[model samples]
Target chain A: DAGITQSPRHKVTETGTPVTLRCHQTENHRYMYWYRQDPGHGLRLIHYSYGVKDTDKGEVSDGYSVSRSKTEDFLLTLESATSSQTSVYFCAISESFRAEGYTFGSGTRLTVV
Target chain B: AQSVTQLDSQVPVFEEAPVELRCNYSSSVSVYLFWYVQYPNQGLQLLLKYLSGSTLVKGINGFEAEFNKSQTSFHLRKPSVHISDTAEYFCAVWNTGNQFYFGTGTSLTVIP
Candidate 1:
C-alpha cells in the first residue's frame, strides 16, 4: 500500500473501447500481478510479470493482456472493454517468488457500459 | 497447482465473542499460507502468514491461525472480536510457482 500505487482509481468506459490500468511500484519488487475481485469468485489472477520483459497468463486471462516494459511498472490492458469485464482490479507486488507474501495496491474500480 | 477453499461464506457472531474462519488448501508440495482481510471498498490487508517453522502464528488485530499439515488447514481465530473486525476474510496459498491461489472468502459480521 505504501510502495505500490494504482492509477485511475475509478473508471467508466464504453464497450468496445480499449482500457489500460497502470500499476507502479517504488519497491522495485521482482514479481507483479493483476487480479480481479468478484462476488462468489473471490480474487482471480489475470496475469503476472516476473521481470521487465517476462510475463505469464493466469486463470482468468482470456480477455485481458499485460505488459511490463520496465521494472517498476506493470500494465493490464483490456483489448476491448465488455460489460462482463467490469470488476475491481488489484495490483500486487512481492519481493520473492517462493518465500515472501504480497503487498497489494488499493485497487481500481472499472465499469464498462 | 494449489487451491484454497473457504467453506463458510458468511458467519455472524456477537461482539466480544470468539470466532473461527475455516480455510483449507490442496497442494502436492509444501506451500506458504496466508490470511487477508478486506474491508468494504478497500484493498486487502495481510492478517497473518505461515511461511514455516511455527504451526501457530499471530497476526494483526489479535488474530491468529494454526497450520495443521495433516488436514491441510489454516484456520483464522480471534478470542474476542470487535465490530471493526467485520470484513471479508480470504485464505491464500502460494505454491512453488509464482501464483497465489485465494479462496472464495468468508464474510464475518459482528453483531451488536
Candidate 2:
C-alpha cells in the first residue's frame, strides 16, 4: 500500500460552495497529481505539482487550483463547486520519470448538489 | 502528446480461463506504458509498467503486458484468472518530459 492519504473520504456540499481536498504523502515524493474519475469519462488530470509552489494546469484544469507548499502535502481546491464537479478525486505521487510506479491515495468522493 | 485507448470496456470470463485486455496508444516519440487496477471502493494500484528494455513486462498478480512498438499497442494478458481478479483496469502512457495519458479503462469480471 502507498503511504498516500486523501482527507474526507466522502463529502457532500451545495452548489457554488468552495471545496478543498487534501492529499498527504509520507514518502516525500517530488511529483504530486490530482485527477477526477467519472463514469464514461474515466480519470482525467486536473493539476500537478513538481515542487513547492511549482504547479501547472492539466487537461481538465479549469475551475480548479492546486498548491504544494511542502513536499508531502498537495491541496486541490475548487473555487466554486458545481454539480458537474461532483466526482471521485484521486491523489497520486510519482518519482521522476515514473520508473517504479505511481502511488495513489484511497480517493475522495465529492458530491455537489 | 500521448493518448491511450482501451478497446474493451467490459470482459467477463470464467475463473481459470485466459483473458486479454486490449490497449492502444498514440505518440510521436517513444513513450512509457502502464497498467493500474482499481477494486470496488478502493484506490488504484499499479499493476505493471513498461519504461524501457523488454517489450514483455510482467506485473504482480500473474498479469503481463506486451508493448508493441509497431502497432502502438500494449495489451494485457493473463493465462488464467481468479475471481479476485475482477476489477477496473486502466492503461496509461507517458511521453518524454513527464506528460501522462490514460485510457477509459476496462472492467474485468471473473465468474466462479
Candidate 3:
C-alpha cells in the first residue's frame, strides 16, 4: 500500500534458467532493499541500494545480483536460477536511515524446479 | 553488527487472553528497535518502533512494547487478542547507517 509494486507476482521456472524480478516504487524513496523469506529464516537481506547506481550486497547475496539505474526502480536478477533459490522475495523502501519505518512490497513467490 | 532474537517460534492462546512475544537484541553501539507483523500472504507491516524517549511504546491493534536498555530486550504485549490477531511477528534492529536485521519471527495463533 506504499505505492510499491513488484512484477511477476508468481513465477515457476526450471533450474539453470535466468530470472529477473522488478520492484517499482512511486514514492521515490532513497533506500531500497531486496530480501528473501524462507521457512524458519524470517527474512534475509539479499541486496540493497542507497541511490541510483549505488548498490551493496547483503548477507545472502551469493546467488543474486541487483541493479538500481533509476530512483524508483530496483531490479534483482538471478543469472542462473537454482532450486535452492526458491523463496518469497520482498522489496522494501525507506525514507531515512533509521528514523522512519520501511514500506514493503506485496512480494514475489518464485519456485524453481 | 546488530542482531535480533525472537525466542518463541509459535504461540497459541485463547480469544481474549493476554499474550507476550519476547524479543532481544545485541549491538555494541546505540541502535533502533522495531516490531513488525505479517498476516497470511501479506508483506510485513510496522507494529511499533523505539527510537528514543519513553521505554514503553504503544502501537496499532492494541499492541505495546517495552524497550529495556539494561535487559537488551523489546518485548511486545497485548492484553486481549482476537482470532483476527493470528499472524507472524518480527523483531528488527538497525544501526546508525543503513543495515537492518530481523529476527526469525514468531507466529501467534489466537484460538477460539
All candidates: CA RMSD (Å): 1.4, 1.3, 1.2
Candidate 3 residue runs with Cα over 4 Å from true position: none
* Candidate 3 lDDT for residue B75: 99
Give lDDT tens digits, candidate 2, residues B1-111. 567889999999999999999999887477889999999988888899998899999999999999998899999999999999999999988887667788999999999
**Collision pairs in model 3:** none
DockQ of each: 0.67, 0.61, 0.68
- In order, the Cα lDDT scores of the candidates are 0.93, 0.91, 0.92
Question: Considering TM-score, where higher is better, how would the candidates rank from best to worst?
Answer: 3, 2, 1
Q: Model 2, A54-76: lDDT tens per residue?
A: 99999999999999999999999
Chain A (candidate 1) TM-score to true chain A: 0.97
Worst 10 residues of 1 chain A by lDDT: A94-103
Tell how far residue A55 is off in model 2, in angstroms: 1.2
- Candidate order by lDDT, decreasing, is 1, 3, 2
Highest DockQ: which candidate?
A: 3
Order candidates by DockQ, high to low. Answer: 3, 1, 2
